[model samples]
Target: MPSLELKAPSLELKVPPVAVMLLVALMMWLVSLITPVIALTFFVRLFIGAMFAVAGIAVALAGVISFMQAHTTVNPTTPNSASNLVDSGIYRFTRNPMYLGLLSMLLGWAVFLASPLALTGTVVFILYMNRFQIKPEEKALLNVFGEAFLQYQAKVRRWL
Candidate 1:
């Protein structure tokens, strides 16, 4: 059987990860601006706000952990260039903790905004990551680590 070779076109002109993140956040804020006022009671809004705050903190912590583990280049689709394959800590749970973290943060923002449109933007972000980031990274990891990558994939989900 022929080995499946995964390939991605050169992304020479893509936006940086930080820039993409900021753009997503900005978009969420824009969504909040257009949201209609609701009749939610003050205490209920406060409770929801607190939930969002907690989610934001959790996402921020995950981002910090991901940054610490990021000893290699920022490109996820180039596992061959990685100094190490991080499979411990949060990595053991989900292959894309950083993306998950960002998603959680965006979800928190959506909640804080009390805007359904902002939540929809968060869903769009997830879809974008699955297509552009996670899929390419999975392919690159399989190419670089072969059986090891497959084993990890079996043990842990792409997201948790």
Candidate 2:
């Protein structure tokens, strides 16, 4: 009998976080316009969305600032480019503060659109990020930072 062969799995569709969020945003807009399953009033939706958007932007920007201050790379595609194990500021709360922020923004969009179905787009974003973006990044971080990375992982939640 011949032995079976298998191929190694690789990251498919290497997309930037911002690009993915943009895609989700586009989906939210299209779904809201076309479907509009939720019937939330304009003022209510706007207020909720605006608050969430502001908070998300703040958190994401804080992560960016922390990276810049640490002088580490923030490019998600190449986690190996990261120079330090950032464990301060917004990073102290969540290991993937930036990704969390993006998720929040997606949630805000979902609320603004007032479409229950559009919320799936947010879940899709998280699922994609977890499998493709964060997992691979963790691998690279473990390789680079070793125990420190592991410690950070232990202390900080992946997404808070």
Candidate 3:
């Protein structure tokens, strides 16, 4: 019988997700300059964008608080430093609330920019994080937490 082997992702966790988000935001700005703006009122855009940003901040903070309460490392770059498996609080719903929060912020930025092209940054961020950040983190967490991590993974969606 032949064994199935998974090739390691080349960029796995090499770039910090926060940095990627910033770069994507810059790119989004450039793209927005070259694209037509969406037809949205200024007040409408401001309100919608602010709502998303606030929600993102809240969600990300919840994840951080959960990790802090659990005495686990919140640093995504060093998943091995995590001392505990946190599946409670916000973690019970989404496996990567931090990343989802960042995504929400990007969405809010896109809406504020009112450029359809700016939305592409959100998509790019998701792809990059999934490949380079989240997947690697999941592997490390599984290794650290064993079946417990697997069970948590099964119960929670990666990003909601």
Candidate 4:
């Protein structure tokens, strides 16, 4: 009989999610300042930014509520401590609602800045999260929750 073997991810740089969000925000501000582009009317920019911010906040709050209900750890650095896998509420639509919320907020910031270059911040954020944060967390989750986690991951989209 052959045994199944899963290769472990090479985990590196475990920064807390809030810190990453702040760093990305700061970089977005720098990008806006350095490469200003696409001027829009005040009300238009405000409206779009506000819309994104509101939606992001709503989704993130829902995630928090679900995590609380499930008594799971929301700490991005410690997925192994999670008591339950929250799949209800906003989670049914997106696997990482909290991260999605942060990304959406970055979009809002970029729109508010009205800079095409600033918008790259959102893409950079997505890539960075996928590489440094999410991949490690996924590995940890698989270790802790095993088959159940894999099934949930198969059904849910990482970001939507």
lDDT of 4: 0.85
In model 4, the Cα lDDT at residue 89 comes to 91
Candidate 1 residues 76-104, lDDT tens each? Answer: 44545756566777777877776776666
TM-score of each: 0.73, 0.90, 0.92, 0.90
Candidate 1 steric clashes: 0
Report the number of clashing residue pairs per model. Answer: 0, 0, 0, 0
Give the distance in Å from residue 37's predicted Cα in candidate 3 to where it truly belongs.
0.9
Rank the models by lDDT, top first: 3, 2, 4, 1
Cα error, candidate 2, residue 155 (Å): 1.4
Name the top lDDT candidate.
Answer: 3
Which is superior by lDDT, 1 or 4? 4
lDDT of each: 0.68, 0.87, 0.90, 0.85
Q: Could you tell me how far off, in angstroms, the CA of residue 82 lies in candidate 1 after the best superposition?
A: 1.6
On TM-score, the leading prediction is 3
Q: For candidate 4, what's the RMSD?
A: 5.8
Tell me the tens digit of each residue's lDDT in model 2 across 1-160.
8757442236533788889999988987887777846777899999999889988999999999999999999888888888988998998899998999999889999888888889989988998888878888899999999999998999899998
| C-alpha lDDT (0 to 100) for residue 156 of candidate 2 | 91
Candidate 4 lands at a TM-score of: 0.90
